[model samples]
Target: MEGYKKIIKKLLFFNEPKKMERFVLKETSSKENRTEDSAENNAEKDKQYRARRRKEPGGIRKIDRGTDESSKKEKEIQKEDENKRKDSEVSVYLSHNLTSMKRLYNIPMNGDVVIREFDIILKDRAVGAFIIFFDGMTDRKVINNNILQPLMMLSSLEIKKAEEDIAEYIKKQILPHNQMKEFTSYRKIMDEVNFGGCAIFVDGIAKAFTGDVKGWEHRGVERPNTELVIRGPQEGFTETIRTNTALIRKRLKDEDLICQNFEIGERSNTPCSMMYIKDIANESLVEEVAKRLKSLKVDYLSDSGELEQFIEDSSFLPAPQIIATERPDRVATALTEGRVAVIMHGSPFVLIMPITAEDMVKSPEDNYVRFPYGNLFRLIRYFGIALSLLLPGLYIAITNYHQEMIPTDLLFSIEAAREMVPFPSVIEILIMEIAFELIREAGIRIPGPIGPTLGIIGALILGQAAVAANIVSPVLIIIVAVTGIGSFAAPNFSLAFSFRILRFAFIIIGAMAGFLGITTGLFIYGMWLVSAKSFGVPFLVPFGPKTANAFTDSILRAPIWKQERRPDYLNPKDDRRQAPISRGWMDNGSKGEDEDEQ
Candidate 1:
């Protein structure tokens, strides 16, 4: 050990201090000489690089190469600051406004951006002005008749007030458009133009007028294709954000309903509306939702689905933390329950957040049906959820490890069916699952009525073929078919997807350790769910934390009159949604007293 230490010191140059010092000094001297030569070469290279940059359109010159990078960064920062300040507000000079607008919008190069120059012939004098908007986005008839014709030809009298701004005069008197909004900031004007609205900038005025002439073609409100109901309002949400908001407003006529607009995605600048009841929704919950949206730094959010992913609590968890639905009625119902609704432009699906697991299992048809009928449907859905999540794993465990659990005749039948199968139970189940998924995907990819027809025919033919070929046993095919049907019964699409993924995990676990492994997975999943939160509200709400109204409203639904209070887990400002005597027609003496006692 002593000899080894000594040898290590020698190799590491620790023992011979003088010799090591001398060698280090020699190396340092050589490095200094090499650095001096490299410095000269670097300076020459910098000069050549600067010369090349100077030839480019608008490059700044630096006096010293040593401060080149720092100077460049400082200049960039100053230039950006100046531009922002200059373009922050509208300018009086029409030429300057024209130049800024052109540069900001990449005019002439942008095929759709139209700059229609016109003169608003006032009685005093003609004022130079221009309107900018995307060609396909703006309605030509509205622009030509409501705006251009009135502004150019209908100015019979001049403004008597000398102090009144021209932009204000034009907004109040000249234009016949209803949705004209005056903006002092160029950023606001630009945003209006991007959203299919047009901006009117006039000379001798330091303000701009924006009109909402958004006329881009969109789908009409139709029966919800994905979530069809037999006994409810058939109108689903459309891609246009304004239309979706209108549908909600038509249902909810309360003055306290507030809809605040937010812009997400730095480059995309997609418009989003966050809505909640002013008196019912908790202030902190509203702030949390806004904070999450404002903090998202993504460049593009294409749909509400994408926005859901950004604001959800946990990304890796199979269960979705937010609910996305295509029906406008559902959005209205959620808002009434003190939930926040996030509606994004260009997507039919609207997102409702801070929801419990029980919310996902509910159907829109529940309210229209009788209380007993609704309760029956809820039970059926819960049973379907159980089958979708655990049926395959249970089947695998029973046949492979818990044979005694099965009856004698059924067990013998299962055995006879699997006699010709080459793969084990696990592999056999996986093959059918994958094949079913492929069929479902292929059906979706094919468009029109053909999609559903193909799905139905394909499933039947595929299952029959697999059974006949002995690739899978008849009993396994029945299990897979039942599982697929149960997954379809899930009310929310996201919840269905989560169950589909967990089904596979459960299958693998049960295959390895039979029923015990399956039980362990469920235990861990339940624990995780108990701890998970949606914007600070417990995910498993009444079940996990044992909150109020768990049984009355969650697992089952009481009569409409019996549900007098909102879900207390939300901590809404006004938890009492209705008075004890909700059924005004019924005599309140006995029923109201009973409710009060509870």
Candidate 2:
């Protein structure tokens, strides 16, 4: 230790051109440690100590001035004093050398030892102190009040002796009986304690004791705003990550369920939790998800949507690569099917990774309803989505480009309707489409009751007035209204938006080349749909690949018991979700009473 100290001292300050002078001073016997008994014997120790000074005092010396000794000796003493002061500052409880206290709790009065300082106070009639160590990561209240007050107000004088006394006092006087464990390590206390934990430091002890002090504002669980359901669990995930995880866990109680957490964002330190189930989930899938999450280097993430875009597999595709669901049961079901779920702090929605095109069409309510009814609704929704996308384009094409395909009576009616209007069919259709879109947009912006009413009134009044004034045909109004209704039938709003944009492209093609243009537009649209993928799975799975089981619930309705296996799109380990012979039907078990009597 002595040799190491000498080396440190020499390396820090004593190295210089005058090696001979430094050696003469340090090697000399004047600077050796002295015994306490010998120090008492020499009454004029200070004067004797200064007699060997190198730079002799010229005149009367001031109290602060050092006696003319070797400059190295004076500097060495000054350095030692400064170091001693720094050590004192760092040690929190100098007088109390408590054995239980960890090294981290030490708050030195000395500059080098003191890690941080915090003000102590009382709150809700409990003694506490605020720990201000981490700049932004830790909550301030836990440090100041939870930790400091308990240590300061302890009745015992000897801190080492008061270990039990302090712990007991905190349980009895300061904290609730259940909170005793909170007055331990600062790390565990802060994390486990319901309230933010506080830490207090004594002078000599290197460790601080933390107590629970976490209580803050939070929102109550409510129905999901975006992913609304007509028939399903009403509860939605809150901003709290713990609450969100609990919501999922409540629905899924399997032992294999795993939730790994990480703190990202350099300054925000936002917590992100990844949820998956073992055995059922693919190991590679979980590893890939964790790797991607670890790779994220952002300052802050406000929502899961922001993270989704950053970590998604494909950026150019309009379809969402991740399935963001607000429903907890949905997340649990996904986990059961061996899919990974990513949940972000301060966001209600949980993101299901490696989603397929099939995910956009599926709903949480699908499992809730009977198979046949559910399948019917699914088919209807698919039809509605198609109508929403192609209705206007098809109408334009049939009326303007492929008039021969139209029925004779329908064509005459359409021509009669158009005769009253001066604008060309394309211009007339475009005008009505734009106006309807504006009305629909306006209705969404205003308050609910008024917004819908205004939209309805505007559409009806404008369409009627336009027809009366010969501005637009009544047939065009009908086409636009049906198109709007079809768009609303889509399950996913993001997918619906993609289809809406695609509608315009079809409309332009139809006007340019008539039947040839419409045929080419359909072909190109089909190709685009086939090419799109969500995650690694094909977006147009059941339709493009033509899998037998994939179409069990696709395009047409299938009976519930017959649809036993899970969709193959997800590559589930347990494909058969239902047992064979689940359908209940028994016919020949008993004889009739009359027949038996005879």
Global lDDT of each model?
A: 0.86, 0.67
**Which candidate comes out best when scored by lDDT?**
1
Q: Show where candidate 1 strays beyond 4 Å.
A: 1-88, 158-165, 588-598
CA RMSD, predictions in order: 14.7, 19.2
Please give the lDDT score at residue 219 for candidate 2.
Answer: 89
Residues 1-598, candidate 2: write the lDDT tens digits.
9999998987889545755544453432244542343756454655655664343122212224444333344557655543333243222343332221223334342232213443323232332223333233344555445444444453333223434544444446654323434332433332332223334443323444444344456788899876777788989999888899999989988788899997667446667899988776767778888988898888877888888888887786666778888888888877876789998888888899776666788777777787867877888888888888778878887887678998999999989988978898888888888898889889989985999899989999998999999999888888888888998888777778777777787778878877688789778766876887655567677777766565666555467677677667767666776766565342122235446777
Can you list the residue pairs that collide in candidate 1? none
**Candidate 2: which stretches are off by over 4 Å?**
1-129, 132-214, 546-551, 555-563, 573-578, 581-598
